[model samples]
Target: LTIVCIVGGGPAGFYTAQHLVKTRPDVQVDIYERLPVPFGLVRFGVAPDHPEVKNVMNTFTQTAQHARCSFHGNVSVGKDVTVQELQEAYHAVVLSYGAEGNRTLGVPGEDLAGVHSAKDFVGWYNGLPTNRDLRPDLRCETAVILGQGNVALDVARILLSPVDILKNTDITQPALDTLAESSVRRVLIVGRRGPLQLACTIKELREMVNLPGTRPEMEASDFECIAKMLKVLPRPRKRLTELLLKVAVETPEETELERRNSAKRAWGFRFFRSPVEILPSDDLTRAAGIRLAVNRLEGEGEDVWAVTTGEVEDVECGLVISSIGYKSLPIDPAVPFDPRKHIIPNTMGRVQKCAGLYCSGWVKRGPTGVIATTMNDSFDTARTLLHDMDEGTLDISTVKPGSAGVTTILEKRGVKPVLFSDWEKIDSEESKRGEGRGKPREKLLDVGEMLKVAWT
Candidate 1:
């Protein structure tokens, strides 16, 4: 029998464990999560209104309940236990800790008030303990978001979404209250490249267009260059580009005028712009605006790059949210990591020069893709591990203790790990709390509160 220790309880870890338990019944898998709760990003990163996307949690729940699988929450790998310790107790260790760090803008005035990373904003609204106190001042009317990804769209949607619509979702009460008092009326999503290179998908874009009381503010010139290439591009890109063109240029003048007159809020895309600095208010205490360098695209398709056009412009805004990207952090000194690419050194999920060690998901590949992408990547890693076991590349002859061994070590360190049942208790309590308010769940926003509930 082989004992496998996965250092995350997110989609990657759950998917890998699912495959292992189904294929190799002889294998016992244990998932260790730093948070008291399971379902890392699915619970904390996904927007509260998008309940359909979170339906995957049902499948993950099944994986966690498997007899051969066990979940140990509130277990920090580097702090609570080391990678070497897991290796000594298990036949293999799979590092699937998804990216927790956010890439910074590295510009002036980033430290100013009203400037925040979209990661923290998402976490703040989603009830992440660390961002519970992120009381973003939404008194300003104009807000600027840097990036053109789904996360950027999500932030925009949440900012512009009707309060009544968001009230019934799982959004934290504190965020709900803050947004209710928001005075923001316009959101400008800026991207370095043109509309053809937008990183967001059609679903997210459609949501923005259909948002109640909101109208799209797009410049016709941004779609002129991409008109001819729409039909020639791939199906998804072609559809997305066509949608943008229709929304930006093809709308009837009468209907467009009516929308402009009637809409209470608006969102728009700004292309060919890169942030040079976040301009500070006169008092230097808050973000007042941003300085952007005009950019022009070179080449075509995925090979395109943004080049500065030697012209700069400043747009006045009170809040700035950077949704550029998520970055993976190096786990411990014992594991191999590439600082340049921000990924673990691996070949097809196998850690380089290290036997019985593997990685998958965002840690194995740079942070990108959706849940489906992570699922495929994690399954591949599990298959590779099983292959090695059969081929004798991984030695499973030593009958090592699995969760029991790790539990003893954690107990010795005075760490009370939250078991799978304990997480279910937390889940039930959250659901019960939300039931009274007509929401899916009212998440606990403090670590101490979460542990208290879990242990009880």
Candidate 2:
């Protein structure tokens, strides 16, 4: 029997596990997750309001239910249990930990108050354990976000949504309640690149514009700013613009009709030009807004967009969040690292220097694509693993990973990995808490609060 131990219980891991069982029922698979539960990005990466985009969980759960598979939660690969030990315990091991770190803005004032990373802010709202306590006090009258992706749109919408719509979402209680109490009225989403070069997918773009109850204010000046950027781009960028423009043309009608019935104010979703410096808040200690230098396309070859000369100016705002991108952080030492790409150097899914050991998802291919693409990536890795398993090609099992002391250490140290059952209780309690407030399930942001909730 082929016993496979899969690390990282995200889409890639689950999909690879599913394929192994489906293709070879004789293969017994055990999935180890660092978190107490499954679903990596879907659980913590996606925006809470976007429950539809998160429907991928259903498919992942069904796969995990297979008779040949079992998931061990609260178990880490590198720290708690190393890959070498898993290899010894199982015939083969697959590493599917996706890109785990937030790509930084790489500028000063990133540590300032009211300055938030899209990952930290989004993860906080989405209930990621590490970021659950992150509360940005976005109630400022104006907020600035750097990036032009769906994430930026989500932040903009969340900033501008009526307290009512926000009350019903899966947003953590701290975030939901804070925003409901926030005085923030305006948001500016800044992008370094031209509008045509924006990294958002069309499906994600529509959800922002056509949110259920709110129509965000789009200033004519902002559209003109974006239009200037769009005019300079090549083919697909123009096409994307035409489509977004059509959406804009139809927005006033949507707002007019929605206003006839609902009390929800329009949600403003605007894109600002390149960002130069994050201006401090009116008080100077907190972020006031951003100092932007208008960018112009310069490089005749590679679509280089840079700040032009003497076009610097400031826009007043309260909070700043950078929704730039994601990068993979090196975890497993066995896999060779490429600092440039933040991914393991590999062909398809095979790690270059190491044999048998391989990577998939963001770690192998760099951070890109959605949940579906993660599945496709893992399938490719699984095939390669199977081929290598048959040949007994690479062997690097020198230091065995031991889980014997893990449970004891966690128990003695008072570290409880939120198990699936623990998560269920947390889920129920959050819902009950929300119901108490006449809102949807509100999350407990603090780790102490979460642990207490789990215990109770």
How many residue pairs clash (N, CA or C atoms closer than 3 angstroms) in each of the candidate models, in the order given?
Answer: 0, 16
lDDT (Cα atoms) of all candidates against the true structure: 0.93, 0.70
lDDT of 1 by residue, 1-456 (tens): 789999999999999999999998799899999999998899999899999989999998999999999999999999999999999999999999999999999998899999999999999999999999999999999999999999999999999998999999999999999999999999999999999899999999999988888998988888886899876799999999888887888855796678767999999999999999999889989999999999998997878999999999999999999999999998799999999999999989999989999998999998899999999999999999999999999999888988888889999999989999999989999999999999999999998998899888
lDDT of 2 by residue, 1-456 (tens): 666777888888888888888887657777778876578888777777677877887777777678878666667778766666565665567778888888877666667788988888888777888886676776667777788777787777777666677677677777777877878755666776544566676766666666655544554543555555656667766777766665554445665666534634344434436667877655668777678776666664335655566678788877888888878887767657899888878877877866556677878787778777888888988888777766667442433232333445546655455555576677688778888777556766556676676667
Model 2 lDDT vs. the true structure? 0.70
Taking all chains together, the TM-score of candidate 2 against the true structure is 0.83
User: Which is the leading candidate under TM-score?
Assistant: 1
Residue 159 local lDDT, model 1: 97
- RMSD (Å) per prediction: 1.1, 4.4
Best by lDDT: 1
* Candidate 2 segments whose C-alpha is farther than 4 A from its true place: 212-239, 247-272, 299-304, 391-456
